[model samples]
Target: MEGVPGSSSEHECDSNSLHSEESKLRLKDAIKHLEQLLLENDLVAPESSGTISHEAMQIGQDLYKSTVEILGSKMFVETEELIMAESDDEEGQFEEIQDDDDSEQYMLPEKDKSMEYIPLDYKIKVVNMAKEHPKWTLKTLHKQGCSRLKSMKHLYRWEEDIKHGGTIIDKYSIINSWTYDRFVEARVNYQQVTTRNLQEWALSAASQFENFPFKASKPWVIKFKKQNRIKQRKITKYVTEKETATLEEILAAADIFRKQTQVLIPNFHKDFIINTDQTGCQYQSTFNRTLSTQRAKAVFVQHKSSNKISHSYTAQYAMTMSGKLLPLVFICLQEATGAFGSKVKKAVDEFVKIYQNVKVTSSKSGKLTTYLYTQFLKEVLSPYVKHEKFLLLIDSWGGQTNPALYDDIFQDDNNVGTCTIKVIPPKCTPLCQPCDVYFYRQVKNLIKRLQNCSFLIEQKREIASREDCIKIHAIVHHQLSAPIFENMLRYAWFASKLTDEREVFMNVNEVCFPLDILKKSCDCKNVTFIRCAHCRANYCFACFYDKYHPSTCTVPSTSTDE
Candidate 1:
């Protein structure tokens, strides 16, 4: 045995070959047993038995071919040799082999697969699916076999982009052209595209395009805050297109007239330009917000009775472009009788004593009639026109724009050769009339404040009498000083587009003499003065009665020592 050591190795090889032949024989016998069991159980139909046998035979042939190819490979032979060597080294050792479960405990876990890039086809599928089932969640899609999009956040962003008219196809994809065009068309047409509409469109697209890879869900749709509704403003007077057009035409004409007047009357002073307008003054206090408990619902406000005859007065005023204010004309509703008339007369006399140009008139209705307007022009306006040429601006009131009134003013013997009358555009008094623009608002505000104070005073005492109303109004009128009037006049002219020289309108603080300046003592020493009723000049009372009382007196004349 020691002489032939190689003979043992040859015997061992023969033994291994014999073991492999026995294992192959056993495998063939097991396969034959499986076929016989299937035939006995009749699991396959008799008609398909031949087909099953043929399939089995074909599978076996494929298996044999793969086995032959693997065994003939160089790598397989090397692997077999390595395994044999390892087995021979362990043959002498007594080792405890592990079971399948014990071996799994020691084995390393399989690594997680990396996130894969989604194809354009898959993205389109997702968008289409989202359109169909807008209410489905990402988890729901995953459960239904849509695993292309991994995260809910990513899915929601994609869904939102599509809803906002984003194209599903990639920018560089060949099929992007059609998708982009469709997206643009949808965006143009769907002005207020809603989540539901987007979802429906996506689902519809998915149906059209076969092989869509993703599913739609509710969790993928973004929510938005609802827009707040705005309240509309209420308009009292509805201005029509025709009225606006007419206003524009009138404005153009007014501009032309202004330029022409400037050229024609080159030396016309701003002081010679005048605007007059009428406003209503109410006896009652205007409603205004007052401090009260936050929760109080019903607040009692004191106001006079709404009697047109006794509660309202028509106030007409004139303002020069140089900011000089003329005396106010109050047209009372009552006739010249009773306590109302007496109080008005007393107030007028007092006002005339203080301001020479003031006048008070009465009418059945508290409005300026043509006759009253003519009286206002004669008494209040005409006295202030010291220039040879003057401009009178008035609104388009029927009484104010009367042809007879215009003729009277121009034909007046006292007027400076030229008296140009310009009627403001209809319904444009607030913007074009200086009195309406500058004076009336301040007058109303002051009047209201005074009225409110009087009302508060009356609350603790007796009701306000007509005399009290008249007194309050007089106080308010007197408080409108020269400087205030001047500022208002400048603002009015500026607003009306009448004057551009701001400096000319400035410095309105110059001393303004009241109409009753002549009523005071004459400048002469040691002489009693009397004012002439016509020329408004102070004279010795005896001399004026003896000389100027019967004739028009031009200058003050003192009595000479007898």
Candidate 2:
């Protein structure tokens, strides 16, 4: 008996080696045909020397390695089939329901499970084993490598199904496999593919099949990720809020908006069509990067105060199609009751006189509310209406879109004509809204640089008070309003795809601090202290401090007073 067992082990080893050789031969032939197909389809890119690129070679090697690994692994058997069937088999069985109210459900398609499939060769082997050993029980068959057969009844059903010419492959299996391939392709291209993205892609690809039942459920995602060796990782690249829609969708909406507004250009002159929006400004914006020793272990830069980065004020800007920034900027400072306290109001009132172009007010959130928006239209926009009719392009913010906000223009006895409002599509602001496309970034750049200069030049450590922030806002707006920046303002519109005419211009940083300009002496004939953002002049520290610049205010105990 011992000698017989030894002979059987040797025979099994020989059989396994034969199977391995056959699999290797088949894989080699398949790879050869795949290479030929790739060449015919022009899938592999060649270098100038007419040789395959290194990238292409690397890709092919990776594919070959993965195929070899798969072929080396033993075929999986569904050992749990009996348990699964038994659990669900009892018709009126009471099952415990688990609460899942807090969990979010996704409708992504399920991954193709190998267990759901039985290879034709394996089926034939199992059927032959049963017929040759007719007295062998189901447990005996399972111990002999027919582990996936749930019961004798299942074996009989499989025989009948195969006798009737039914296929071993499940319906829609190929399509489901293709959907997974598409996901892998998308992931390789650096797309931040979400569960929704997978679901949508699967549904679109499977739409041709009737009643395809893949929902891309949570379980499917788990299995698909595990099988593909994918891991969830944080995105290192810059991303924006525009992911609500695809690039094509955003571009299409922008094109529609451009066409719609272009038709009205002839009716309203360039100066009469205005684009306006509000942006939040930090009191003391600081640079997130700075100079340090090349091999330093760590780097640190000091900020004025925590509130400088945490608190913000709103500044609204209006620019016409003629490339002119409206003369005034409407500013709303954060305060309770949407109005400044006694002390702060007095300081703001006095500051506005010095800087006439800034109309300062207060709001609870420092955001442009409907009430504050109406005031902006009246105090800032109404004064600039030179034509009988004008067009306004704004975002879809609730405050800006209020119908009552435009009633004054239509109900005017002064024959001001009708004011038409065109809203930029939702989530399309980054591509179609002029202010968001280019203007706000430039403004923020200016704010951070100015704050850094104050720290480096004057050595001020305290946070920029509300008054200093307002002053900085005025200076930045005043500088941007210059005739020199006209083309830059127009470029905002062009960049947003609202205008066809392209205007080449430098942003605030490049224009203000050119190497040649920075080399020159100040107007006071001394070393340049800082470029006066308000007057656009170079002044020495002494001259600027005594005459041009205001003394830094004392740091307040809190951001705002009651």
Candidate 3:
């Protein structure tokens, strides 16, 4: 009786174990199928998500339930071990697949690969080979010596594409998405966009990131523009400043200014009536056009001081209705503490001794200030006026518009009597300001030409320092003060509608650099390089730069005196 009970119980236990193994096998097959689905759809969740998809969750639940049923008594320890082992294997495979997918994401597309572009001549040759031996396979071509022949299928495709007159189709898309985003933002903000700008931006983006398929080439620019539907249009107009009011308002203000100054003009002498303005002058001026070969698409000039072009200083000029420039020019240089250092002050003192007409000062912002304006009045205008009752025309700059600011300078000095100040109407400088209409443009053009001549003749690349600016201004002031420039100054008053008479005048270039002067000899008896505007004499580079003429022209009988 005992042997029968033991035998029956053992039979029941064997049946249970067999059933558990079958269920485990089914669960594993289901898991395999789910893995296949996930792989095909690229649905492998990253470990950082800390969760899985619904299908994966179902698989986990079924797996856990089955393990619990199979090993009921020891389910805790063994089930944990089993699930860990299975997950370890699956995670290893999944991670490998993920790594492969990441690398594929970075790989350049087929059309962007440089190898895809074949020469037209080579394509024609390949087509000719095909025509000669229609039955020969690409393998046969390789055997018969076709250079760069790798894929037979690709060779056949190329011949067909060539027959259809299709191009080789190698092109590029934007590799750095950040660059594209930034480019669109810039365009939306009305920034000027160019192919070179795009190339530079792409290169910069590539430097900061990894695996960016950047191509800073013309072809890439062409393709990118086409892909984005961008077109190059000629810029019809550029807006320098926002309009303050409607057209009628500007005209009315200008008219009011003309009428207000009409009476005072009769009382003041042409030589006594003065217009003063301050303009920003760059340390280094660059030329827009240069001599270049006809075949060249781009022209470049060598400039070692190119980096300093952005820095600027202020220059104040005064002109009279009789077309005469004042003898002195006030220059405000950029300094850190609103003053110059001891060494620079000494140099400036020395410089002023040579060019006695130039007045040099400093401000932290390099702009005209109340104190500097007073200094200019005391140092420059007071000495030259000589007890003249004059009318002063100036723009409505905050520092100059205040009438009380001029009290101390003229009150203490008898030479400069009580003067009248006339402010140009707001927002009408371009229409009613004398300096804006004529003088500033002429001065700037002359400065640019002189700078260019200095570079081309002497191979000088130094930026105009504070002393250099003072010298240049002195030379320019002396040149414009000539009797020849009288008509030019008169034209400025006429252009501003301050005077009814229109005067005919030639510009600085026409007056200074005549063709006749080009063939003359310099003061040093060398071939003429430039006409000295200050001395009205031709000078070679050696005489001008080496001897420091005009700037240091203090001798009695030489080209130094006016």
Alpha-carbon deviation at 430 in model 2, angstroms: 0.9
lDDT of 1 by residue, 415-449 (tens): 43467777776644534555654456566655554
Poorest 10 consecutive residues of model 3 by lDDT?
85-94
Per-residue lDDT of candidate 3, residues 35-111 (tens digit): 54344334554233666687767776676555444444322222112211111112111111113234324333454
Please report, as a residue range, the 10-residue window in candidate 2 with the lowest summed lDDT. Answer: 79-88
Would you estimate the TM-scores of all the predictions? 0.42, 0.54, 0.54
Question: Which one is best on lDDT?
Answer: 3
Q: Give the count of colliding residue pairs in each prediction.
A: 9, 5, 1
Candidate 3 overall lDDT versus native: 0.63
Query: Candidate 1, after superposition: displacement of residue 54 in Å?
Result: 79
Quote the lDDT for 327 in model 3: 83
Error of 1 at 355 (Å): 7.3
Model 3: lDDT of residue 542: 66
lDDT of 2: 0.61
Model 3: residues >4 Å from true position, as ranges? 1-243, 294-299, 412-417, 454-458, 523-525, 532-536, 545-548, 551-562
Model 1 residue 459 lDDT score: 48
**CA lDDT, every model vs. true structure:** 0.47, 0.61, 0.63
| 1: Cα error in model 2, Å | 71
